[model samples]
Target: MQPRSPNTAVKFAHQVKHWRLAEDIRAFCAAARQSGAATDWTQWAENYAAAIDSLAAPLGMPPDPPAGQHDLRDYFRGDTYAHPWPFDKDGQWILADDGVDG
Candidate 1:
């Protein structure tokens, strides 16, 4: 099999990063609303994580942690909340980096 191109690899990495961030944000939001050790910071962290994913995805890549992980914490280690891109973004339909968004 042929080795994946640099562009392809980058794209995959980006996607993974993006997804991870989203997961973190979602978790943070949940924790903030709930009462417990979790606090507002938790929510911010999650949002930042999600933002990273969003930014990376546009470059043709997967979200961090490769999606379906236990939680965003395992996926990313950051200080700022990463916002996810709107569903209408081109990256949303990126099936592959074949020059087509889908």
Candidate 2:
């Protein structure tokens, strides 16, 4: 399912994309650590294959969430679950919190 507010969805997508990029970097670092500092022809080929087989890979299957991150839609939309954001007296998202004049 998608969010009711298009702006909110777009903002969330942007944030998620950034997170995905970071995850990709972390995955690459992990692979490098496993392979060691030096890389011969076989090691290079294996590393390349492993990189593409990672969850962050463009062609690899998606991986499960690290631990949390389940049921984030309600937290972000606030239409169903009471979002823990809007750390103000009023229950409203701030301008910097991806508020779109709602």
Query: Which candidate comes out best when scored by lDDT?
Result: 1
Tell me the RMSD of model 2 versus the true structure. 14.1
List ranges where model 2 is wrong by over 4 Å.
Answer: 1-4, 38-102
Off by over 4 Å in 1: 1-3, 36-102
Tens digits of per-residue lDDT, candidate 2, 1-102, equal 856455556655665666566566556666766778434654565555455443443432233322222434545544533444433344333454464566
* Candidate 2 minimal-lDDT segment of 10 residues: 60-69
In angstroms, give how far residue 43 of model 2 lies from its true place.
21
Worst 10 residues of 1 by lDDT: 61-70
Question: What TM-score does model 2 achieve against the real structure?
Answer: 0.32
> What are the models' TM-scores?
0.35, 0.32
